[model samples]
Target chain A: MTKKIPVLFSVGWNACINCGACVAICPQEAGFISPFDTIAVDRPCDIACMLCEAICPVTTITHELAPLKTN
Target chain B: MARYRPYFTLYLGSMDKQYDLVIVGSGPAGATVGRFAAQAGLKVLIIDKRQELGAPIQCSGAVSRHALEEVGITPNAEFIQEPIYGFGIYNQIGDCTTIDYRQLKGDEYGPEKGKKPLGYVVDRRRFDRYLMTMAERAGAIVWLKTEGLGYAATGNGHCDVQMRRFNEFLTIRTRILVGADGLQSQVGKWAGLRTHIKITELASCLQYVVDQVETEGLLEIITGHEWAPGGYAWVFPKGHGYAEIGLGVIPTMTQQNAQWHLKKFMEQSFFQKRFKNARILEIQGGGVPLASPLRVQFADNLILVGDAARHVNPITGGGIHTALSGGYIAASFLIDFLQEDRDASAKNMEGYQEQWLAALGNKMWKLHGIKTKIFHNQNIVERDQQLYATMSDYFSPHSEYKKI
Candidate 1:
């Protein structure tokens, strides 16, 4: 089993209004609305930098600590 | 040198067109001025960076009935969501004090007495579009997705405004320029207008449009450090089951950010249960100036209004009324000056500041004083308690609350 990070990004897709405010205010460019008009996070997320979480107008983007997997 | 020559040559001939007046930003302030100026037969052009009239909505969408009427706007079903007759103020510990407009003393309720609604929660997108439409109908040319990059005074009573329309670069000349852009206005800076508000005078806010919120026709305001340090949280009901729940905070007063405060507020004992069955429909955030208007709003051939001029109520963070009123005031002066063929210099435009001060500046200053005293009180609980205790005094006809 491969070791995975203990945290993951979760998006409440239904709550997103596709306002693009998150995209404009995010300092890391970590989050954006897809061409299909849905919220999407960039790959290899900058977990330490929480600017996306802080600036999200709707609190759509959040993080949850994952349980450690046993090998 | 040859490669750079073509681009430099292109810049030299970029001036595209000219207008009598150029207004930037299509919010209520800009649109209001555009409408009045166009109606007066002045060649006007209004531009906004947004593709749509109202995207990434920044306001809670609450406007007083009087404010709408003052701007010559009548509330109809298309935008008015709910009519609010009163409000409730709450503390961190779940203590609430309610104020009913009907029970208030004196002429504060206007001539309609108990019949009129105190305020209304509106669909901000539609409302902003309505204002823009009005401007367009009044003969103002509106350009969307147009951003003002910078400007230069041509020194001949006109300015050359550089702009970017989507992918194209362009410039428009205008005898007079108006900056109605919201907080963080670049126009104010480009015009060399001294309109800087201290960081402590700004409120960072975040709000959500939610469904399944059960409430009467009343606005809810929650205060205290736990709710929002140096500011307050609000729940403006938008008819049916939808409501706008948001809060603002002075950045320097709290280590935690507005997002943290909002999340904690949603999970609070009082609000957690209410929001459990609720669904958030949209999210919006922006900064508001909680200070007095700028001392100087006019420079040579330029004027700043609305949030760009810091014309927000420091205590309540309300700017729509002032913005609308300021737009009208600016138009009245601009129309007179232009019609008389007066030079659009700083001295000629000084009347705008004087007229605006006479209209709303004193009220804003008084509110700023009250806001300072309230935020300075160290004990949150005691402050709220004292506020609740004095809530009745606000209903008095002679009270300063009546002025607001």
Candidate 2:
């Protein structure tokens, strides 16, 4: 059986202001944002929880379900 | 996503922990309430999602001396960057106006006649940690890097709060909950409180901390449509050749965002030369709600304070003082409700709203009106100049502007 993962929606990077609110609020530490850059500090983990999306002040982060491929 | 379900279930096993009050966010408001409640002997727990107590700084960190006094905080030398005595307002057309603290009247939160400093620019990161230390000393349990995910009001008036600490899930049972989670509070949403602020009522802001910059003690405020269409730009000195340069804009009024305006302001002839050799230390940005307080801030087993309650000053976008006051006020009411009445029902918490209104509601409403008038006019620079020039006469010393 293939597993599933969470991915950043298309609008995530463009809409993100790099406020780090998403990074702070993410329960699984899925988001990696930095004040020095406009992009994510690290690739977000595939945590299914949408806390980052729910807590984004600008509604910048969103997520979608993706299949996890077996090696 | 499905791969994480089993991990979630593994962490869901409840660890028995309970408190009389649980406050979220760990900012000034949460720390203040936690300190007061713990000092009064209540079992209090305060949590913040941030790894550091105050990181990814969101504020310009200006607060009046009286605001500090009202919350029982003495001006600590370590965190105070500079003492401000007045403001220097400049227009795009090169008009200037200055308002001195001495010209202002005394209000409930104003300094005494002989007081030399009207306000101080602070290091917010240090200041917030200092407040958390106070709460810790007073016996409040603080959990850094803990995010409050959601909560459910148990039928008996207690709330079961679900939280995530890094990868671990935990549950906390509390008699009362306070949401100090700021402008986009998840706590407010989970509590079913009406916490929405219209887009027109929000100010999007961005700032840069520059070192080796030339600055005087007085704060410099620049205004004009060309500078910041719906708001203003400020250069607040942090002493020893450091300053915070920032601007705010109402998104609805301008085609450009705050960052665009800030860049434009920096390139202008007046500031370009000064910033040429200055070192950019850090960048900060966030949104602030510029509106009246939420009509309903209390629900069954819950209360909202600070920016979560939209307690920011509508005109100045200042919230630190109000957050402190609101936290202290909420703590008082919670003490009365929990200790005196031995109840934490929504009904018992109504006093929090009532008392807060008596303290700040009327003033905030009036400022909202003034802010509306100021922002709607065509000549914001001229109107702002006139307003500041006559502020000593038009507003009492107790005005929100004085404290903000």
**Residue-level lDDT tens digits of model 1 in B38-76:** 999999989887778766687888887888898788887
Candidate 1: residue B335 lDDT (0-100): 90
Q: Show where candidate 2 strays beyond 4 Å.
A: A1-17, A20-71, B1-16, B102-116, B269-276, B378-401
Residue pairs that clash (backbone atoms under 3 angstroms), model 2:
A4-B1, A5-B1
- State the lDDT of candidate 2 residue by residue for A1-71, as single tens digits: 54536565333666565564443344342114342322242344465555444434355555554545469
lDDT of each: 0.74, 0.74
Candidate 1 CAPRI assessment class: incorrect
TM-score of 1: 0.79
**Candidate 1, DockQ score (0 to 1):** 0.09
Q: Could you tell me which 10 consecutive residues in candidate 2 chain A have the lowest summed lDDT?
A: A30-39
* All-Cα superposition RMSD per candidate: 8.9, 7.8
TM-score of chain A of 2: 0.56
